[model samples]
Target chain A: MKKLMNDPERIVSSFLDGLVAANGTLIQRLEGTDVIVRRSSPPQKVGLVSGGGSGHEPAHAGYVGKGMLDAAVAGEVFTSPGADQFFAAIQAADQGEGVLLLIKNYNGDVMNGEMAQEMAEAEGIKTEMVIINDDVAVNDPDQRRGIAGTVLVQKITGALAETGASLQDAKRIAEKTVSRVRSMSVALTPCTLPAVAQPSFDLAEDEMEVGIGIHGERGMDRREVASSEKTAQLLLESVLKEIPSAAPLALLINGMGSTPLMEQHVFANDVIKQLDRDIQHTYVGDYMTSLDMAGVSLTLLAVDDELSSYLQAPVHTVQWTQC
Target chain B: MKKLMNDPERIVSSFLDGLVAANGTLIQRLEGTDVIVRRSSPPQKVGLVSGGGSGHEPAHAGYVGKGMLDAAVAGEVFTSPGADQFFAAIQAADQGEGVLLLIKNYNGDVMNGEMAQEMAEAEGIKTEMVIINDDVAVNDPDQRRGIAGTVLVQKITGALAETGASLQDAKRIAEKTVSRVRSMSVALTPCTLPAVAQPSFDLAEDEMEVGIGIHGERGMDRREVASSEKTAQLLLESVLKEIPSAAPLALLINGMGSTPLMEQHVFANDVIKQLDRDIQHTYVGDYMTSLDMAGVSLTLLAVDDELSSYLQAPVHTVQWTQC
Candidate 1:
């Protein structure tokens, strides 16, 4: 409860203000809504846009730049932006070529993105949608919540878009990337909401909640806390079962907020040590987060040569970038 | 007390292993030492080498790349690297143009850096040192512990070194940056050392430690918890007192390990709203950290045209990059 915020109700707006202030030259805020867009984009290329609740740092907003999201429509923490806001974002992101919306598989996000796409299409802006459902914890893929694999989706598609791919082509790549990536997360501690002064959930000192969703949704079960080695094995085992022989994949050891890079790196090392497949690349840091949750998630993206090229494409962004 | 580490005794080396696992292509680990060096460097350019402890990640190691430090030596958590390790870094970084060692002004760091400099000089590699003492919290500037401002010193000097500046020129610019920048920090909670089960210190529920050092060193005073506005005002006022009337300075709002980016951004917003001077630039996030400490430090680097140019210069590293 000792967070540095202005007013509980003002957390969303104030955080957006700070985002703009920190990267003013790189991003431009929409006049009214909680939206941030690239300062300038090529008019003849397909534009990319993605967004959701605000608590996940760098997920939607940090990807809004040259090689990733063209615009990000933000809602309150763990809440979706209004459909009208998403429509406005579509309008802002529509280059003459068209626009593609990257929506995570959350109910509110899906609804708003669908509505915005419809609205933009009616306005003759030519819009498409690619819903990402890469979380493997849920029994049904459609019901699975999107997690860190969403970044890989945005990244590969964004890089493809940077190559002047059409809306159809970018959407195709996005859908293909989505099919190849799978992610799962476990939380050692729960995050507190600004609107609520208490944590969303709690665990005992020696226990952890496994298979937890990003928004503190119920996971599979709770278990006694173990060494990072055991933790990495358990998380990776869940992911490896889906594609046992998918060698030469990219690994993303993402921190679910409040986990320091020291521990993230340690967990990453354990993941590598415990992995059975060949890793082409490993990304370690905070890409998506639950507000102050201290935990780590492992994401594996099955990358072929074409997907590898897209992953290697140079990107300049506020958060994720490559030289 | 839950962290994703194998053993507290081996955290330093294991963390370094993970760092290389994540960025193996960009760096190489020195044999038998806890030092990582950029794989390649321009032989004609002055090289930069920095090291202290393992906890302030992305500071020394994350900064090692084409346009930054050529080598970064890491030590045990909250401790200084051995003098031998620094010497190895200097040797690894020394090109024909010579090398410059950037050392923070902690007692252990300064002592080891000086010893390393002597060893490197005895071996006939041209070497110079610039000790960073930018903390405004401590009354005596010479004895002040270097904190986040040390990164500014590395970045500006690294950019200058990229321009093929001579050893003397790079050293001079680093010294100038160290003199111009001043910083202060406040912590809501104390960091727990991995080697120790308990926190370095304790704070009451309604209390905070102002001006705390990165390694949980005691600050000037402990006061009742204040709003982000009041906290920002107090930290900035202390930094501004040392550098009155200085405008157009780059602001670095750094997080101690466990603070969420959402809160950091909120704090950054408050800093802008409360600042009396016009800010030229603002960089926010966990550049330097105490191990899993929930707090922030504000660094103001007074910049003119030359310093501004260096700050804008393009560099590529694992953690930091400018497009």
Candidate 2:
């Protein structure tokens, strides 16, 4: 893989180093840990922490700010962070108000996050948690994988925390958002892990992978390569089939890196036209990306008055800002 | 070439439609021209107008706002806009104060922008022009190509225009910026034009093009693939050789689409470590991209008290923002 990196083994550490350096004004990495936290934290506000792997960037760490996540613990590319790091992030973000751990539903992530919660509680940190499983590609809700929908969770719940809400209140918002969000992606190309020179999976020139996961996880099926119209139809319909909402919603068209914004915009245009409900808000850009995978994912969140208020709230992060 | 697009002929039009639709709150397209204007323009300030080809999205269009260009005209992918559209942009952005035309130094863009300037004058609107040619790869200083350095010009000059400066003052700042800025790029993969299915050029697994242009034009030379450190060393040395400034400066590490943030961040990390002068500011991202080209370019603008003041001024647009 022709990637701009130093050593393959240093990808995660050096990336965090570069990220903290680039955005040092707003964020800082915890000393000797893989956790990133706000440069300065207000002690009385409820703390919110979310994280998963490193490859899906601008997701967990990029959301750290005053009105969003307080801290983000990063794992190796597509690998879950150890419990020790998660515990450290909780301690760094935790204030007198309490801490909330936002976990995506993956085996390693859930195990480590839960362990961190137990450890924090033993220290009387008053921490609670919410695990996101919003990807509808899988038939079982419990079996669903979390994808770009986690960003909506981060935004809405983080906004909730910004209001001086109690830990329970923040947990309630996370659960509410978890129930209303759905996401799925189609991959035109597979991304190779830096440590491994070859792509994780292979697709012929005339094929596409459907319902793919962020970590290059196998999708439900593969299909013939087709026009953008056909790709949008499949993803939009798959999302609708799983969770059809009659309420106004928010749409996020996320690029799996290497997909240009031009194509993302085209895919977003197709997605919105096929949606059946009123789109109260639309986010079309590269919010969360899988490393150099030329694909896009569609995320829909059912937004009522309350959800819309949180989504529209002011936020300033490195990769995202809405005034 | 694989891409997420509808009809090849309608790529530019549909992409603009999606852009306007997605960023409805920030920008709007003029009635029939390939021109984008701010949703609402404040008429008293000296208006800033810029246009060139499409594909380098979020460049001219995304910079349209209260503190930046009042309007931006776009042409087809890598193709200059027709004179008719440039004229329409001039008319749309013109206010009683005057209008400043920011043209990138390309034969077609220069010809069409100049034509539009004459047409605007015929209609009795005061107009000023600045053509930027900051690429150092071409030895002929008069014929050096314009690349990502134009964004710095737009930001600084546009900020000047926002301060209610006279047309003459804005023109002066643009000229000063053009003089101090120098840039060069390296491409790991070639970009394919939508109208044509093939990439502009070819590269083997172990080769890369140095000093490449935004439109995949020939660079200074090619060499076997090297480490990221080597890449940064070559680019930074080449830029220093041509411009060689002793003053503090701003650094921009721009990605030519398809390069991930992780890679961009790595490249930026390397660039900063090699620089000898004080870096007043650093911007690392996909500022001005060539369509799906897996590459990056480095731009250095020698900054003094005056230029630094304009560079740090707060301006919010769709793709970039600082509070």
Candidate 3:
């Protein structure tokens, strides 16, 4: 697939620069690094930091704003950032109250995030890390990868941190948020990396990849493409089986880059109709995306009063804004 | 270009139902019509309404909320909504106050909107209409089509109407807003309708359509696809030439559905770098789209003190919200 980029090597940096320029009032990029931080983080509050690969456009960076992440470190497309970059983000976000790291359950991200926490500690800053493994597609828990559910965790944890929670408190709440959320994706068409000339995977015109990874990794199963209703039912049943409780839920229908909002909504309608539960909140859009991958991911967060309130709290960011 | 829809004939209704389901707190559909209105429009305030074809996902519907549009009429995919549907929107939005229709400069939309206006008048409801022709791609004024710039006009005029401006005052400001905006688009790939087997237009692997319309219409020119920098330079130069004055600008980098946000931001960065004038606001996202066409459109709106203030006013809608 042809991309609208200049140099594939500089694509991530270019997107970050553009984002900071467009949202200069709310965010700023740390010079010489791929770390973007809130322009004015609340003083003496537990700072929130999250980072991962770059293809997820709004994932790590779009969540950096008021009432969300204090800093987001970006790596190259579909690749984790360096440990030093994560450490830089920790330093920038750390106040007197310490910092909390929300790491996705990818091997590189986990290793680098832990290394950054250590680096921050060596510099006399307190830090805590929470690993999110919300994808229920994989049968083995250890093999699960974090996906769109990370956004829900960010929203709740960021709001908790903004309320001046201690690092321990924020860490506990973030861990809870992570545990209660589950996500799975379906890819109708594979995404191509800017530097790559071919798509990540191939599918027949009538085929789809189910339980797909956000970084264009192949899914657990493949099937002939079905109607939106059937697709939503398949994803929802898989997600519901892994959910921990029958509590009120928050539904997120996330578009995989190239999926139209029209299709997302159609899929969402089918999902909502098939589900029989107390759904408190419904968000549909491209929250966490795989670059130009045409598909949708369903995220279900079992919510109680605490999680529900935080989800509804006012957040002003570039991609996800509620005011 | 396969879609995640059940029936092409029911796609519009399904999308509207899904939208209302997701954003029930903010907006609702008028019983049997494809008209979405704000949940509770302030009484005695001049109403703001906008609508067009259904493919522009957030354009007319996403703008319906507290400080923007009171109602949005949706037609089929790329087809104009019926005059009666628009009249339903007008009657529902009019809360003992006059209603203002913001019509895009399309032949069918203009005709249907005018018919709706007459129907409302016959029913003893006051109404006014403003036609927006912001696309500078067409050389002939009469042939221009309204595009993404319609979003800016909706924002400013919606805020104006909320301030209890008379219908005449609202129409005046709406016209002024329309006159100050200019937009141009470039498409890398064409979109296919859900029921159609072929794309609207075909492009060579390395070619792009310039000056493209939102309805998958053929562009005025075609050229080999270039780097993001070159593409932005071409679109920005065309837009700047048609801009009326040196007033500070509000820039909009709109993604034609299916264009990844990464590419959109990369394009936005290039556009911002090439512009030499003062820009007060920059919005980069899929504000308006042409189904799943892969492209980007740049909109430049000259803003004065009055326009700037209204543009920045707080609005609460499904697609756009500011506290």
Q: Cα lDDT of all candidates, in order?
A: 0.88, 0.87, 0.92
> Candidate 2 has which clashing residue pairs, if any?
none
RMSD of each: 1.4, 1.4, 0.8
Give the docking tier of candidate 2: medium
Candidate order by DockQ, decreasing, is: 3, 1, 2
Pick the lDDT winner: 3
A1-323: candidate 1 lDDT, tens digit per residue: 77877688898888888999888888989998898999987668798989999899877888888888899988999999888889899889887788999999999999988888888888999988999887888978879899999999999999999888999999899999998889999899999998897899889888898899999987998999888899999999898877648557999999999998989988988999888677887899999999999999999988899899989888767887676
The TM-scores, one per candidate, come to 0.98, 0.98, 0.99
Best by DockQ: 3
The candidate 3 chain B region of ten consecutive residues with least summed lDDT is B237-246
* Candidate with the greatest TM-score versus the true structure: 3
User: Candidate 3 on A138-208: residue-level lDDT in tens?
Assistant: 87888889999999999999988888889999999999998889999999999999998999989999999
Q: Can you give the lDDT of residue B40 in candidate 2?
A: 73
Q: Please provide, for model 3 over B171-234, each residue's C-alpha lDDT reduced to its tens digit, 9 standing for 90 to 100.
A: 9999999888999999999998988879988899999999999998888899999999999999
- What are the per-model numbers of colliding residue pairs? 0, 0, 0
